[model samples]
Target: MDGLHSQQNVDLEEFRRRVQQGNDPHGPVRETLSRLGDRWTPLILMILRTGIMRYTQLLKEINSMADSPVSQRILTLKLRACERDGFIQRTVIPTVPPQVEYGLTDLGQAMVQELNRLIGWLEVHEVQINACRAEYDAH
Candidate 1:
């Protein structure tokens, strides 16, 4: 029991050390994740990858992906955060009805590449991941 407790403490300390070392050598990676690591941010980025899109267009794209889609309010909030983090740009064109468009910035383009790489890795390993989950759950 004592050995097990000591091993747990060592494991926890290693975890804490890693988390505390955030952003020193990994500013870009950490920043990107911080900006886009949300339920809807990656989806929004993926949608905008094609080209600029209107608000309703983005909403529709997301809605088509899932049955219970993201709410307008949540999408708005995520967009604002992405804009603030320099991942995206929101342009409002002057018109009678006002045309608003959202698109990715250079930073966002880079983020998209990273995200695509992550998606690729997941696609390759999804079966293994699901099998691991099933094995764990069976125990």
Candidate 2:
């Protein structure tokens, strides 16, 4: 198999093993999912993948991609959550007006790579997935 497919399978097997073994693997898995699996978190991460961005820049960038713009309060909450989870680093610059920037941490970068792998897999199997969905819907 190709390197990507091989790596994907290996990762899947490792994940399966982790989930299958031990008594409470679900707790850790669920914690991770609950932390990062929110509606806006993925989009925020995807934007951060580009480079460091100021708060307003991130807000505008995400808003451009989203059909419904996110509220400032919600954005603040997401950023705080990402920061708390150690997925993103928030840097503050003490200027006359105070400037802040956000970028992916090492952990965040690793998560982005994993997300890429999943995205690649989805791209590869999208047609098949659509076909299956259609078949199921017809039945």
Candidate 3:
């Protein structure tokens, strides 16, 4: 038991050192995950990837995702955060109803490439992930 514990500690220390060495063991990936992990953010980005979309269009797109239903208030908050982070830009048109469209900035477009890569990785490994989960649960 003590030997196993020591081995785990050594593994953890090695991971910490790797991260501290700017090996980016997780920093960039974690930062992106933290930003895009919000249920609506990625969905919003995916929707805007097609083209600029109005707030209503975003709401509808998000609603179609099914499992996670973002409320209007939450949607507003997520958009504001994304805008503040320079991930997305909001354009307000001078119209009677005040038309607002959201689109990805150049920075946001770059992020989409990263997101696409991550999604592709997940697609390839999804079965493995599910199998691991099943194995763990079976234990």
Candidate 4:
């Protein structure tokens, strides 16, 4: 029992080192996950996946579909954060009005694809999940 416990502790420590250490590859993934988990970013990325979109266009589409619309200030902040994180590319067109557009970068597209897979899984298991939640809540 002691030997098994010692091995489990070693494994747990290694897990922490890989995930928590800056030099470890997993640390960056953890950081990116935290950023991507924000409220409006997933919606923004999903919209951008179709094609490049103007700021107002994307904002309108997102706000229309959401229960509580994202404010212009919040949307701008999330867009800047996404651009900074290399998840989206921003292009400014010098028209009479100076239009700005956003599109998913290669990295962003890849991430959206992965996120879709997770959403698909959730859709498939939603019934089971609800049942489990009900059971847990009853107890």
Per-candidate Cα RMSD to the true structure, in Å, reads 6.5, 5.9, 6.3, 3.8
Q: Which ten residues in a row have the lowest lDDT in candidate 1?
A: 23-32
Candidate 4 structure quality by residue, lDDT tens digits, 26-57: 45666677767888888998889999999999
Flag clash pairs in model 2.
none
Query: How are the candidates ranked when ordered by TM-score, highest leading?
Result: 4, 2, 1, 3
* Candidate 1 regions with alpha-carbon error over 4 angstroms: 1-18, 21-35
In model 4, which regions exceed 4 Å deviation? 1-14, 22-27
- For model 2 the local lDDT of residue 117 reads 90
How far is 18's C-alpha from truth in model 3 (Å)? 8.5
User: Roughly what TM-score does model 4 have, to 2 decimal places?
Assistant: 0.83
List TM-scores for all candidates, in order: 0.77, 0.78, 0.76, 0.83
Q: For residue 4, what is the lDDT in candidate 1?
A: 100
**lDDT (Cα atoms) of all candidates against the true structure:** 0.88, 0.89, 0.86, 0.90
Candidate 2, after superposition: displacement of residue 84 in Å? 1.1
Report lDDT (Cα) of residue 39, candidate 1.
72
- Candidate 2 lDDT tens digits, 1-139: 6999999999999988877653464555655677566778888998999999999999999999998999999999999988887899999999989999999999999988888898899999999999999999999
Supply the global lDDT for candidate 1. Answer: 0.88
Residue-level lDDT of model 3, residues 14-67, one tens digit each, is 999866764564565555567688667888887788889999989998899758
> Which model, 2 or 3, shows the larger lDDT?
2
lDDT of 1 by residue, 13-50 (tens): 98887677664654654656675666788899999999
